[model samples]
Target: MATKGPEVVTDSKEIAEIYKEFSKFPSLSKASIGPEVISQYGGKYCNIYTEWSQRDLERAEWVKFCRQYIMFYDEDSIVYTGPSGNCTELQGELLTEESPSGIFKAVLRKHTNKKGEEKQFLEIWNKNSKEKSINLSGLDMHGKVYEDDQFGCLVWSHSETHILYIAEKKRPKTETFFQTKPQIDMTEEDEDSIKPEKQKPVKGDVFVYWEDWGEELVKKSTPVLCVLDIESNSISILEGIPDHISPGQAFWAPNDTGIIFVGWDHEPQRLGLQHCTNRKSGLYYVDLTGGNCEQLSSQAKAVWSPRLSPDKCRIVYFEGDVGGPHHRCSKLCMYDWYTKVTSTVVDIVNQPGEDGFTGIYSSALPQNCWAMDSQRVLIGTPQRSRKDLLVINITTRNVTSLTSGSDAGSWTLLSIHQDLMVVTWSSPNCPPSLKVGFLPAAGKEQRVTWVALNETKILPGINWKILTFTPPLEQKNPKFPAMNFEGILVTPSEREEGAPTPIIVWPHGGPHSVFTAEWMLYPVTLCRLGFAVLLINYRGSIGFGQNSVFSLPGNVGSQDVKDVQFAAEFVMKEEFINTSKVFIIGNSHGGFLASHLIGQYPEFYKACAMRNPVINIASELGATDIPDWCTVEAGFEYTTGQLPTPPLLEAMLSKSPISFASQVKSPVLLMLGEKDKRVPPAQGLEFYRALKARGVPVRLLWYPDNNHSLSKVDAEADGFMNITLWFIKYL
Candidate 1:
């Protein structure tokens, strides 16, 4: 019943056209997408002020207001272009400064917020007329002042000058700053100069952030608490943690005399600390107001993002099981200051696993990237077997499913403004867009309103339908025979609405990771572009029990790759899927599988795209930056324990895609972030060069400013844009 397959073409002419069309789609090199996220109140929701008599309250209004980047603009204004680009004018009263002669000013920039360019900036305003044209924020990476309203006119100036002018408070122009290299106090390098006496507080290290809170500001590089004084526009440091800590989640205590920060103190290699992990970490409070610090929690492993209630009555944080083989899955815990009692707030232990759909902890998240609010907690439950948005009841401990894992959608809580919550959602098929949802009262369904839809793509207009197919039963590993193996499939809603769609067999990146049916932009983008995406939860992925996840070590090559192959065969049998036009794409571990699939089954796929792929398994083992001590903790030797002595090396090499490069017949597109230290750019370059040398079709794209993950807005856009081109050409 399946649609007719494409005729096999061995002739060079067909392959030539495929390669040429792939090259025609202009590859994106620069950031074309705007800002994807914005935050207020540390990017979480919870109203603070019960009431405010003045326009700005220092603790409730001014302090919180000054902590974030605020946009300024006038309601009545025509768009104008300056020397640099289009601009908007804003005028507001100088809330912080004492200057009586308020100045008015205007600014210019794109209305759409892009990721890296989100820095606030300002220009100069004339003092005489209380008005000035906003100037372009040039090469200076420092924050600036843009607009001011005072007396009768508007004024504006850059924050770099450390000067303030008066202007109207309504839609006033202001400035934003940029990051510049800090001047280190290196004068003491002179051997003769008496070393400045190292000052030590009664207990902790004194940490300070110049503008933003971060650990990078410290000279000694110890884990210290970074604090900001909005009244004085100054920073302070409080140090006392056991080891060097990156500035994780931190906040000034209600007393304001002290602050609290969380960091890890454990064996780095055992827990993959190279990628930022803390084995033994807890909550500690330092009295900047001058008092002995106190330990708030025990030595339970923790993930950063900590939150304090408005009244400072309770502290909420994520707590991981201590000293376990599977410590990654943590639960949400809360501690009450008044009762002096600690308890598990959410029942993560009962959460269902991805494998047998049985309740068990795999992954519970409140990563530094997510936010929380007063009425409910917005938690990222990646282990719900899908990327889920879970709304937790603050008082009753009840959980509600907000958004189902759409495999095509991503939901993020940005900021909270009174009764409204601002969230962002995006997918491969959808341009990132903003949404506002009304905070549901206790025990009520949250009513959400979609706003500012990203107009960059048209995929959302098409409907998508779900498709399911059971993969053939896998022969259990000779070693781990108890493990279960299966795969999942998804199709666009458009298929039943009209015509059959092409197929894209997707393999998740982690040899130990599984792909969920949750909404994601990546696969959604392909489906929107007219392809049926089949994402498999191969043998090694989590959500399944321990046996399933641990099975990956010895099976990354044979069993793992077969899971993908079996998935392809299942979808190919579906009457609605076009079997002939399949393509494969993946990154990191998935990249390894994609490369291997193309080599092993070249005739099955039309093309492939790899992002920061791992080509040589053996090379990765020796060259990976992970600490040498990790070999024992990762259990690599144990997994390959039964291999015969002579063929051990060959077994590892056989799993590597690079070894079989000569067999690859499909066109390949590879991209890597220059700063990605995890799976370095060398991995992709090595494979690209190898395939090109053998006269196989290939293209390589490298991002200079990004890391293992493209966190920057522009870099992410460029990465996704290139992905679009690859599929448009080959599939």
Candidate 2:
């Protein structure tokens, strides 16, 4: 006879306390340190930079009080606080030397009222000038000027008269028509009141493929490039842009004669912007005076990170087949304006390190990639599950690794000014911190200096160690070569020697995504709860070379499953791990793996917890925003409009977790986000129904307002508490 799991328990006070403790664990959200905006004043190379810190968790929400710190740094490392005291949010900042009094800064500010309503305004400040501050609040352009994650820039023209930026604007309202019939024997007043008013139907896009359409901005508003005249405080929308194109990453062309930007066609059937590498986008240039738009990369399927050479003779950009897999290889192309020719400077293909490439430059490369000489660019690429900085010589097509070794964590190249390179460095055991490094001149080796350490609340009784293991050769799938995979083993620091501890196996989503040695809240919390947490980066995960990442496309369930089982088995060999008390947790694709593990190896795990897992590929194909995900992962070529045929659906079903549902014997907890477009709520409900129909122990916890990330503070807190309880009850 099957045994039922313990009844679901809810302790609101305990959950609140856990959330309070988790809030103190700070994570760096944003950092601004780059060469283009670094101010050189009074014989000191200084810059105005800002960092957003996760300060406090909202009591009733899943977000945090992201406190902003705007500071000024000089060559001597003296930090001066700026005017961030009254602002609830720092929207954007632009620095320019065109002002008569040294350098001036234009910053956008957002203030939240007691009622939680937000109002934004623009402020111009010059410390040395008599007009220390000027507020441009009344000159509203109907949308926000700030776009997060390196998508848009608030920039000043070379002449400094006008500021250019991207802002959302309301779509034009459509006219409505209606017909009315006269009322019988109605008086004049009655007839006047009975007149029918035109009814306008609500208009909105279905967003079939565009899942990440309106994040952090107003819905139904179109993003448009606009120019603001500082002197007159008047805004003018840039003209000549086609209605079917939405512009981003806009900046002034050389000499401020025009604007150069990357634009995506407004295809209703196009995939979401989060999967931008799969979208057909192009680089375009529009003259400021004539407002004539010209397509720059017409021959390329997708173009991004377009930058003009300092000499103004050439333009360099990345071009790739957007229809390829998520981590598609891209070619660095240089266009010579003088010769009217274009050539590939370097082809970034996937291969083993030291001789071959890992992946394309990060999508956020434009923010801090250019070198002083303009002939070299600094980029970050995934190498064996860690992000490494690479210097690519555009002139010679040479790629040099600046940071690589056992201590390899993740490095973000922020800015290169003169010989100084600014970066954010972090490892599995270390939190992200800002660092200053030397930009090697010619053949000099690179070195770094720590600038600021991130504030972290260390849990008194928790500890973690990084580990790697090679599965037995016999366990490897014939189709995919065996490679050593990596994982982090987190455990309570004060456990008795040789004492058995419950183990939680965690697999990351995006079979293409790798688990970096970054600070994650959930894993740390699990470790604090006296459980050994194993975060595995199996085959097909990024950070490895192209071969390893592409190896699992046609073998998702089989190869990936074998790798996870091998990892779990290898870890279980340790006498300190209680094999009988083992549990598993996963999100998205990771959840897919967890479901498969519990089903295929039914007796191996005591319980399973999945968050927005992909249950059935066949059903997911019609509902998921990334339908191409199903086809591509199933070993089929990715296509935009192709619907799954009967045979293809069968193949997908055969590869899905639902195929092995009947074999699952462990209790399951399904945490689903109702608004998740990536893996719809139905995916979780489907798995729940399957387990329930079989009388397997099951429970469903749904967050109605959260999205796929489940990152909202409330949902995240709830999920952590529920999962902890579920594991404790069943493991």
Candidate 3:
């Protein structure tokens, strides 16, 4: 870390100026990587990723204009002019998937948004792929297209004759109950009824109830498997899927004979599907010719992401329990298609070995992760403060760490073509950059090589290092063995003996989500402001082994909270930290800890800020989209139709940060998204109102149009700047 020289800001207003300057920093992203199609298009492979939009948009402009450079790049770093696809022209591109033969690309793009409807167009293009945008209501399509990670993945068949996707089924038309039915009556003069007599209507089932997948998938329900015939432009809503399960992550089966997908169970009730791999789901193969829906994986256990090898003889997937930490280190299991057998290739690592391969903390495997040999697959997972790439050979069960240890920052497999692989790497100081490389020998993936696509700009004067900590041995749970966790300490370029820098203790949202030390805008901007940031990976965080993750379920408020508190204690002892100006920040579960910390250790923190935080579990249970989360994380197995008992309520309240509100003295800032369904906006409101009642210095910022993430460029800008200002004021 740098020992000393950047300028310091004594005024909070200076943060706004810094925000505008940082806003000029270009936004770059690289995705949809593929091998060179025609020799003419130079480079080992091709990729599509977006660039920038100023954070200075007016509120109305936020809705009117959203811009980002969704450009294409190859070895030359030039705009894509290839015949396979042209993504640079489209805006709001949702999902892009390549065909098995790599002859074409299918892209989904948002078009317009009329009241109660979301308009989008689907295109399959190299040069002449048609762009079709139709009013879903005109086509009798019910809900908007499923373009999210949960239940929607666009897929193309091997024959290239059809494409398959998921969309919400049109709900049953309803009316108020008790409405009279139309009746036929004979006319007095003709003695024959020419028309049905109008009947007086009283009521109908207009207010009838139906449930949807909460949070990000709130409007999605009862998804139908849609197959589109390419040549005829006709769609077939395949009907063999069990009505009890909602299908997602679908892919075309071998020879395009059937479709393989993960079917999430909505039998009892649908729960939130975002950021959760533990939902009860099964791997199913649905035959296109016969509509035969066959359960390919164990029906009772939760399974997801079934990737068929390039050779088409085998499949690999993740297996976990029905519920717990929404995501954890899961067993990677593979199945032989011909033999109809399944085996655990990488069994769950209860505790990582000293070498540190801590099972698989799956997000989603790349669509093109297969190597040329078809025996190995590449996937990325968080390892301590960094994200590591690993190659897993299903046949041999040998796992190779492509980018191991915290020093590498993070490695994401974009796509692999023939034997050439495309991966993106980014660290605390560097922005994400695309690179082309080749996979190493089978068990020897320990060594790797790469050629950068373009030079990446580094965050000026920024430096960082990974700091490790362990749970107090006496307080550690015996069941959860791997107690050591890590944090990324980001310091400004310069250090001075007399000027100890203010440090922010930042924790992640998942409680299970690992805080990767990558190039994120907010943390980097904070570092540019001369603040040291400690991004924590608490005990229950994923990527550190299942034992570490399973440790926090029944122990949330206490263990996770103490971990943050102890982290601060660990950092405060450092020579360059300003103990008098220590502050904390968290979002979601991280917020839960921040609130607890301020209250539990009243005099320690100078101030605190949280976004869409969980304030009161007891109150949040009835409002949150993921009530299952409330029950499971509170040490109870969620059962459908189970109401909270007095004991459950008591336990939840005791575990909530709200209980400690009275003891809090530090000023607080709450950044909330009104549309957030995961952790309802009310959660933050509850805290804001409490702090108000107690006369604690508090400020609440409402982003009415944003969701749980406050992901809109404007909202993100608003929140980031305010957070900096809040801390600046105190410092």
Model 2, C-alpha of 228: deviation from truth (Å): 1.6
* Ranking of all predicted structures according to lDDT, beginning with the best and ending with the worst: 3, 2, 1
List lDDT for all candidates, in order.
Answer: 0.49, 0.69, 0.78
Best by lDDT: 3
Clashing pairs in 2: 61-714, 62-712, 62-713, 62-714, 63-713, 384-543, 385-543
lDDT of 1 at 175: 25
How high is each candidate's TM-score? 0.60, 0.83, 0.89
- In Å, residue 220's CA in model 1 sits off its true spot by 12
How many residue pairs clash (N, CA or C atoms closer than 3 angstroms) in each of the candidate models, in the order given? Answer: 88, 7, 15
TM-score of 3: 0.89
What's the lDDT for residue 525 in model 2? 58
lDDT of 2 at 108: 58
User: Candidate 1 residues 455-478, lDDT tens each?
Assistant: 234343334433433334554566
Estimate, for each residue in 241-287, the C-alpha lDDT of model 3 and write its tens digit: 99899988898888888989999899888888889888888999999
Instruction: Please identify which of the two predictions, 2 or 3, would achieve the higher TM-score against the true structure.
Output: 3
Query: Tens digit of lDDT per residue, candidate 2, span 1-731?
Result: 33222221245465456556655654444444423335555433334344444534555532223333343545424344333443253333332222322256555556666988666655566655433333433445455554454355677676667777777653333322343345367566775675232223224432223223532321423678888787877778898997777788787777888998888775655455563465678888899899899888864487777766655677788787766466545677887766867888877555655564565635656454667677777777666656788877877787777776424567777656554566667665455665555565555434433444334334566566657767677756565554667777777666555557788999889877777766677886566556788898897777665566667787888888888888888889963688888999999999999999999999999999999999898899988767778888988887657867888998899999999999999999999988887888999999999999999999999898888888877787778888888887874
| Candidate 3 RMSD computed on C-alpha atoms after optimal superposition onto the true structure | 4.9
Best candidate (score: TM-score): 3
